[model samples]
Target: MKLAYWMYAGPAHIGTLRIASSFKNVHAIMHAPLGDDYFNVMRSMLSRERNFTPVTTSVVDRNVLARGSQEKVVDNITRKDAEEHPDLIVLTPTCTSSILQEDLHNFVERAQLEAKSDVMLADVNHYRFNELQAADRTLHQIVQYYIEKARKKGELPEGKTEKPSVNIIGTSTLGFHNQHDCTELKRLMADLGIEVNTIIPEGASVSELKKMPRAWFNLVPYRELGLMAAVYLQEQFGTPYIDITPMGVVETARCIRKIQQVINEQGADVDYEDFINEQTLHVSQAAWFSRSIDCQNLTGKKAVVFGDNTHAAAVTKILAREMGIHVVWAGTYCKYDADWFREQVSEYCDEVLITDDHGEIGDAIARVEPSAIFGTQMERHVGKRLDIPCGVIASPIHVQNFPIGYKPFLGYEGTNQITDLIYNSFTLGMEDHLLEIFGGHDTKEVITKGISADSDLNWTKDGQAELNKIPGFVRGKVKRNTEKFARDRGFKEINAEVLYAAKEAVGA
Candidate 1:
């Protein structure tokens, strides 16, 4: 494996734990070492849950491994079942425990026979899958299990169809702005006369999961988490799903139209034209502000975006196509969806860097030197090192990313938030104008004259003019380097030849 300071996604078993902790009356039993249960911090600390997270670890310590046994798995499962009385118990092996060749399915079956709560084994192949894929596969398996249970109960031969309603299938624990996105989407759908049947893995119960097939369609917004489960529903229960992640004004409008089209296909007489118009006209101030002269100064400015697939694609679209910003660099750490990301951002991105390593991203940032950066916490650190402005837009984030305010990055409201973030991240208005006019705080001649007046270096007028041709951002650094070069040598003054010699010496 590769050594890295941070990871874009956790191990496969952590994905299963995320799904388990997201739901109510569901507990995850991890058969691994004591410290392997790091997901507890994400659920409790990141999500800021006051209640204890529903997860237990059957620590496989030296004593247990030396004895060639792991009786703690069953014991922990039984204890958690007795204490919590959860509706379901998800048993899984961690990345390290996968090497032990543990029969987790057999253990879950035995627990099912003994305990009142049902048991489901998340047989995640950690070597073949990662966090997003593992989470998707586990959720798909759980959905299949519930559908089979409904079939056994004679609910329907396959599944029952009902009125036009949508089941949101992507809200998970520690997702980027998940709770607010769910709330905004539900509000948008409700205003259009559509009812939300259930939102999976977020405040949803086992009973609600079984009712997933009753909805007219599924709303799978996130590209990383929920698309697999939606496809499973379509194959098993004839339920169609819409995969549209709304992030900016144009994308949010497209998502709304797609929802309307799906509802119409299901023989529903729904009209949201008035509501859409009203919301886009009055509620969406960001779109209106972009067209105004106040924001026109930001048009065609350069930006660099790096994040997960969903946010990266949406931000690229908004900045380049909608807001008239120039995208100097675009990339992501999500290698699973790299092809899709490239296809979506082909028009905007000149070069795409798809890897988990943050160093590559930092190199790209140094080369591009965009005015602003949109990325995660790691990119935030890189921007700080280079003195560039950055805003956190993706996951694997810090505690500050989880703000108490309702800052969603999903729909119309999210569009407003994005606009505000970009406005604040870059030099704007009179400040930008002044910096450009004054040569970034000091004119070239003034800086050179002041340096010569204070120091031993002397510059000819032509040399000073050539130095002034350099970009203002790096001009000061270049001048300092040139002075050091002259001082190091026996030269007492800096002319055009001296400046050119210094450039060669320092490899500027």
Candidate 2:
């Protein structure tokens, strides 16, 4: 059996719901059993984040299952939310709801009529759909509902722009990266004197979303939202869009100038590199540090990546190009234009794995015997059993207090963090000891020689020599903190001791 995944396309999205729950003016009505909604809360709790925004959810039960109770269910929901008068009510049907072939649209329409509340419909087909679909469906429904509502109310949602602002789509749940990408885009748009309408599925509220049509344009940082919203807007509001994502500095620069061109053909092309450098101020320092540390040690370290399409592509790009690490197998539980990614990474590996199931990815990783892995909780277990070092890059991430747009592995600083984690995972005794004692200390050579002074400590010359073979360019500049354990810190620097520590760490 394979675990399923997908890339989302719309506003009534779980990703948007996930991020929006943290902001005001957001309401997501999960049409699932109570537990499904609770599971979301559980994920947030595990991540130690107050990320999921609380939305009124109507639990569809066995009784609702046995009979076609769409109207009754909608009535109950409307009454509950009508008291507070929610600006927008998101009607999300679960996998169970989808199974029953419930008329979710009709149900929402009835609910809207029954109460004065504006309604948005999200069709979450469980058997066939995953979080990505939920997000896509949600975004679509929210955008459509808002557009119509705005027309009826004669209220155009316009920002400061006298001409027209742009909406950043595909941000909520469509298998997109939240680690600073959104923040970077926001900053970029602001710098351009363009008031971004809102990040759909993240900052845009049901009320605010209703007026989405007024925005002159839409900007999708990722693909799913961009293409889908573009289609919907063309048919409905007739709003146009540009498929643009600001990833690396080059891409960011090209995109900024492209946007300028789209808005005004004669628009002055500004220096995009300057904008990027100003926004990601720490990028230079992080890059210098990452390049100085044990990045060389990570070379030929095989990797297996399983995440969203966009992130997987991003990870492999950085791993192969930036760190000189090898990605043996990479895949996304996401669907998109694989061609773009295929071209960039095809030469790096013999085979590129892309799928929406864990069994397939798990099997692939198991067979490849990679040195490290980057995925989620399940992949961590896979890496553990297979004797590989796995860094969690996807969800079931229980760390919530970590700020958004704070990918330690992104840009320069993030690159440094990635290198450190990788090096730390593979580091062995005496050489590891040397890295510790003198990597950052004032005495440098003296500290390292002193730490390795115990000739009878039983450190392997071969391992130390092999460690030296790693390229200096690949190593991060930041020194490993080894001063504490410099002088025979209780533990011996023998192969057996270090090996034991490594094994115990992963329970291998």
Q: Whose lDDT is greatest here? A: 1
lDDT of 2 by residue, 208-227 (tens): 66656666677866654446
TM-scores for every predicted model:
0.85, 0.69
Return the number of clashes found in candidate 1: 0
lDDT of each: 0.79, 0.55
What's the true lDDT of residue 479 in model 2? Answer: 10
For each of the candidates, the C-alpha root-mean-square deviation to the true structure, in angstroms, is 6.4, 10.3
Q: Model 1, range 163-203, lDDT digits (tens) per residue?
A: 56889998987888888888888887777777898899878
Candidate no. 1 TM-score: 0.85
lDDT of 2: 0.55
Clashing pairs for predicted structure model 1, backbone only: none
- Which 10-residue window of candidate 1 scores lowest in summed lDDT? 444-453
